[model samples]
Target: MAIQKNVLRVADLPQKKPTQFDIQPEAAQLDQITDQLELSALRKVRFKGVVAPIGQRDWELTAHLGATVVQPCVVTLAPVTTRIEEDISRLYLRELPEISEGSEIEMNTDDTVEALPATLNLDDILIEALALALPLYPKADDAALTQAAFTKPGEKAMTDDDARPFAGLASLRDKLNKDSDGSA
Candidate 1:
């Protein structure tokens, strides 16, 4: 069966067949998402996918997410627009691997595997995937970081070259060598 609602109960689904789903947020929903994500704008977004039973108990969801987002440039604060298209895969397992308490366990290699939930909320998955796919530091095409120095009025401002710990030592060594050669 095709699904459109935001939430789906696993027990209510047909156990033998894959269920297709498509989600497109309305304008108000988009605005809520934009605010929730701290985005300047979320003009469009869509998620379409299929959930299928794996074996007798487990399930898997595979989806494609597309979005047009706007965020401030990290350096210049100008609006930076980005088009995002991502494919997402998640496996719902009836039983997750065991990790004993107080034991140092290596991180699981597969991040997509998750414990099966009684009900799956499509909106939560869509928001999570969108959040993960967004660029951490969005930059406009012409945005650049310019350097500036700050100091007290009477004090010399420190530049990048001067900030190096050994920079002054090199000039001091050169002067010392010149003096020794002249004395010799």
Candidate 2:
């Protein structure tokens, strides 16, 4: 879901150039995260964003960010440190109509602009960048070894169960198919 209120409006923020940002307290705890599923992870986040004005209703935001995501070993549940780096760009538009919700809305990509604000929220930009940095599946090397240890040596692999329980369906279908083919 979109972080509804968290995104700072372009008009509301200053149009100043992008600058480096370092968030404390919030970031300082990053190393403390050890796979607490029910809790927000601690993370050190750093990012830089540059805004280029396009037209009256648009701007191009380019950003790069880095974070350390404390993931767990898939097998042993040990804390695994994962480093992430991301480069993101977005075309910010004002007053987007619901009918044109598709990404077809044209934007001036050629670095043209009517104006920019003096400054903007750096946290929102970093949050967005970090969100993208989240990995689909995180695992540690030990986790792989743990799973490998669960298998039996030289054991036969089990077959996946067929979802349709009627094992005779294939034979019956073959008979019917033969009848139909013969008639044709």
Candidate 3:
């Protein structure tokens, strides 16, 4: 059976009770999440969490999320595998803070707090959290950028330092000083 994306209904949540959820995305769902995250590949994704009411209209949600992903190395373009684990927490409010056009909304930035919608979409949250946890630059353990051997048709290959414009500036300065001394 295909996994349902959104499962939690905030309205039906019992007062003073905590609800637990454990979700493991199937192959198809993992593919969808991988596409959404723009990852090279996703081997697995799992989330285990609990949601409990804290106040009359407020709730606290906490989850332990884990995922295995594959990304391209930034320098070598090789596939790099990564395992991600995160302890996620959020506070849901029944009433969202009002904001008008061109108005500033004040919010507490310390915690992941948001307005509670009619239903909570765990799939969406899982995708978002995984994307955030992914490394911006992934590189294989042994991948390193060696000196380039790129050269135009007949030109000699240039080393990395040779490609820099100022690499020979000190030598030029020394030759100029020697020439000046000889002329004197």
Cα lDDT, model 3, residue 88: 91
Residues 1-184, candidate 2: write the lDDT tens digits.
Answer: 2222224556654445443334432422333222223223546555656666565556777776766677655566777677888886765555443545656756656532223343355555565456556765666665554112233679754333333566568879999999999999
- Please, what are the lDDT tens digits per residue for candidate 1 over residues 1-184? 2223599899997899999999999887888789889999998799999999999999999999999999999999999999999999999999998999999999989999999999988988998999999999999899877889899999989899998999999999999999999999
Q: Which is the better candidate, 1 or 2, if ranked by lDDT? A: 1
lDDT of 3 by residue, 1-184 (tens): 4356657888898987999889898888988777777789998688989989988989888999999999999998899999999999988988867778997777657659888878888877887788889999999999887766977999888787776898699789999999999999
Instruction: Give the winner by TM-score: 1 or 2.
Output: 1
Candidate 1 achieves a global lDDT of 0.93
The true-structure Cα RMSD of candidate 2 reads 8.8
Q: Write down the worst ten-residue block by lDDT for model 1.
A: 1-10
Return the clash pairs for model 1, or none: none
Off by over 4 Å in 1: 1-5, 102-104
- For model 3, state the Cα shift of residue 126 in Å: 0.9
Residue clash pairs of candidate 3: none
lDDT on C-alpha atoms for all candidate structures: 0.93, 0.54, 0.86
Clashes of each: 0, 10, 0
lDDT at residue 83 of model 2 (Cα atoms) = 80
Q: In lDDT terms, how accurate is model 3?
A: 0.86
